[model samples]
Target: MTPRIVILGGGSVGMYTALRLQRRLRRGEAHITLIDVDSYMTYQPFLPEAAAGNLEARHVVVSLRRVLPRCTILNGVVDAIDTSRHEVEFRPHKGPPRRIGYDLLVVCPGSVSRTLPIPGLAENGIGFKTIEEAIHLRNHVLGQMDLAESTQDERIRRQALTFVFVGAGFAGVEALAELEDMAHDACRYYPSIEPADLKWYLVEATDRILPEVGPEMGMWTLEQLRHRGIDVRLRTKLESVKDGRVVLDDGSAFDTDTLVWTAGVKPNPVVARSDLPIDGKGRVRATPFLNVEGYDDVFTAGDCAAVPDLTRPGEFTAPNAQHAVRQARVMADNLLATIRGTRRRPYRHAYAGSVASLGLHKGVAQIYGVKLRGALAWLIHRTYHLTKMPTLNRKVRVLLDWTLALFFRRDITALGALTDPRREFEYAARTTAEPVAHV
Candidate 1:
């Protein structure tokens, strides 16, 4: 029998590992399997653009089956890993639990949206991680405008136009910038909507936003956002969103219809379930080579794995697309080396800098000690992600979207009804279709 290689969580690391393994290992040398809850591996960097109507939502995600043809793709979440027995328990869409035994296990379960216990947040706040959430937010924003224009109630209109985003990291800043830009542009189509009528608020508990880009860039970003009429409330914490009332810890409250949470992320809960050593943040502890501690047969990578940063000595690699993709390559080579009895190498990388897009023609980037802003940064931002995007097909389509966006108005159509196609079908079933008289 061939050696069994099973990978959990088909995110970037998991998918990339499968790709590299397919290229290196012979067809009959080893059997590789990839498991994930979702069928598509999302390019998270484009989520903001997808929400802003810049890129087609579908184009930002890569199909696992299409990308990893040689590897057996398992569409399910890994519930638990039995390291002692070399087996994994999985549950797929209400199906009974199934166990898959493996000789070598790779855990890259990825991360989940980190949420806090704020009043009414659980019911009202929308997350910015998934494509579904992005699409939903787009519809909700547009729908709020429609509701405001049609309704005669002043309070309701005010709430409808108000938008709030918590956290000021790259996701929060880019999302705030993009949505503010999109809303401003969209207001042109709404006869009754004034640009001032839409209130865009960004709340950051820290002293600055976009800390990944350093202090100077962060200050510049704040000024740029404020110049665009966005309320950048730094060093402020959100107290509650109870009943649509946004209460801030600084003794401020406002009624708002939208609340977006981009605070941060924690590793997938599956890591905690396993007996593997985990950090306080729930990340699996791994050496620089991406091998799990005390378990030679197990390897981990991406956001879920705390692969130590050899360059930094004590710090683990930061959880970002840049690090995840790089780690995946190293993990793949190390795995192959293990199989072939070759020497394994350690993972070592330095920070290459960061980039954040603020809308159509605005952005900030710092690379190799060079600072970039405005359209140039925006162009660089697009160029970098385009190169990093998984497949050539996706890259070409994203480029086409950007090219067409320059000539055409952003598509603001909110197909909220798509969320529940059955609702319409049920309505039509009751209204239009003639009932078979007890046939």
Candidate 2:
């Protein structure tokens, strides 16, 4: 009988693992099944651009079925993994949860947005994780501008125009910058609102922003954002957001219609229940070879695995796309080696540094100890991600998006209705339809 191989999470690790495995495995050697909540893999780096209208939303996500033709794709959630039985409880969209057995298990469920218990945050704060949120944020931000333009009440207008982002990390900074740039460009169309009327605030609990970049580059990014009239409040905490009223620990308070939460992410909570050896951070503990500690049959990688950083002794690699992609390749090859009874190699790659896009022609980077700023940094940021983006199909689409963007004015159309396409129809059907006589 062929071995049943089950890979969890269609993220960087799971997708690449299955992709590489499908290419190498002979028919009937093993049955490969990959599962994810989302059918498409989001190129997360381009999310800010998609939010800012620099790239079409569809271009930033790759269809899993189209790319992984050789593997079985299951769109659902894994409720639990029972290592003792080599079975996982899977829950499909329209079916009751069921158990699926596997001979080999690979865990790579990615991270979700880390949020806080602050009041009104759950109700008001929007995350920057999925492409859905990105699109909604774009429409919501522009819609706020429209509200400001038409509102008669000054307080409501002010609240609508005020935008507060509660993190200074890459997602928070880039998202704030891109939307701000787009909003500023959009001000020309609003007769009543000027760019200066918009209030943007970035609140960070730490003194520095973009800490993934070196201290120097982080400081440079701070200065750049501040120079653009953005308020960067460091060493501050968001105390509350009750009723759209943002309260900071520093005794400041304000009302805003938009509050973006991009503080950080914890590893997928599923790791905690996987019956695997996980570290203090709730990440699956793994050997340098990317195998679960003391379990040769089980493998893990990407954000969910705490694989050691070989370059830096006694430390784990950062959970970024750079490391995730590299680790996936090594993990996949190691799995092949295990199947072939060959030697498994350890995964090791030095940190290459970080690059972030601030807006259209604005960015920052520190790659291989070389620092870059402004347009040069922005160009490098685009080039690096473009090369890293999976498949020629997506690469060309994203490239053409940029090429066409050069000749086109920004599209500021608010697609808030995309959030609920059936609202109008439902309302029309309820109000205009003839009444039912026999219920």
Lowest lDDT 10-residue stretch of candidate 2: 430-439
The segments of candidate 1 whose C-alpha lies over 4 angstroms from its true place after superposition are 428-435
Q: Which stretches of candidate 2 lie over 4 Å from their true place?
A: 433-439
Error of 2 at 146 (Å): 1.2
RMSD to native for every prediction? Answer: 1.4, 1.5
Could you say which candidate leads in lDDT? 2
lDDT tens readout by residue for model 2, 102-197: 988899999988887888999999999899999999999999998999999999999999999989999999999999999999999999998999
Cα lDDT for residue 415, candidate 1: 82
Q: What is the TM-score of each candidate against the true structure?
A: 0.97, 0.98
